[model samples]
Target: MYAAVEETVQARLILSPHRSVRLRTVLSYLPEDPFAVSMAFPAEFSLDEAEDERSAEDIVWVFARQLLSSGLELPAGLGDVHVRPTVGRRTMVELRAPEGTALLRFDTTDLRRFLWRSRLLVPEGEEHLHLDADRALAQLLG
Candidate 1:
């Protein structure tokens, strides 16, 4: 049987007046996978030319990168970060974190994936509360 593991990370979300958002996150790894990781702002959060609406795929990417970056050790087994933008019903990005590699899947047909993962699937939401980008980045560095 496949065992499911839940991990947590803390991050700050910066939203500009233009609606551009940046996420600074730190991922903490578990004993099973030992390496802490950090990401300043992954490309998924880049909304350069996007109109007013924020794409679910972008949001998912930010969350995924944030969570993965928190782990104990970035998995060496995973070659490199794999990002798949708007494809079929879901968008996915795969990358190694400190603990282990993570595959973030965002369902375009249902926003439930975002809400559920944020609330239930991941560790306690308290560990990943919202914060400022600069502060979050500082924590990652220190």
Candidate 2:
């Protein structure tokens, strides 16, 4: 059995070329959800701005772990989220929704370090071994 892995990396909220805000972004992986990775940000950084009364909470975005891995070298993802390497050894993450979008920049080294740590627990090509097919099928049919 694999344990959960979590890391917090500093990110820049690119509001504009001339302005940006520093944010603490949390990256998490759980053995139960082997195929996916999650990024959690402050609730205010949500892609949907329509919610005017948000309590103190986190907005978590879950996506394929492969998406984030491939994105480090080339662009990945096509739907509500996108990740790609940027100049200066940084990575750009775009969160898109009908209401709004949030652009974030993260250090490539930080991301790589976190991925490496996660691989130590689950390893590459071993994620499938951690999945419970029966539980997933039951959840789908329930």
Error of 2 at 113 (Å): 1.1
Query: Which candidate leads the pack in lDDT?
Result: 2
lDDT tens digits, residue span 13-130, model 2: 9998899999999999887888888999888876565656357578888988888899999999999889999999999999887777889999999989888888878888999998
| Residue-by-residue lDDT tens digits, candidate 1, 1-142 | 2122333323323243244232443222222222212223344544444434444332222234333322212232234555343445443445454444445443433222333343343444443433346865788899
Q: Candidate 2: misplaced stretches above 4 Å?
A: 50-56
Whole-model lDDT per candidate: 0.37, 0.88
Model 1 bad stretches (over 4 Å): 1-82, 111-142
Q: Estimate each model's TM-score.
A: 0.22, 0.91
Task: For model 1, state the Cα shift of residue 83 in Å.
Answer: 3.5
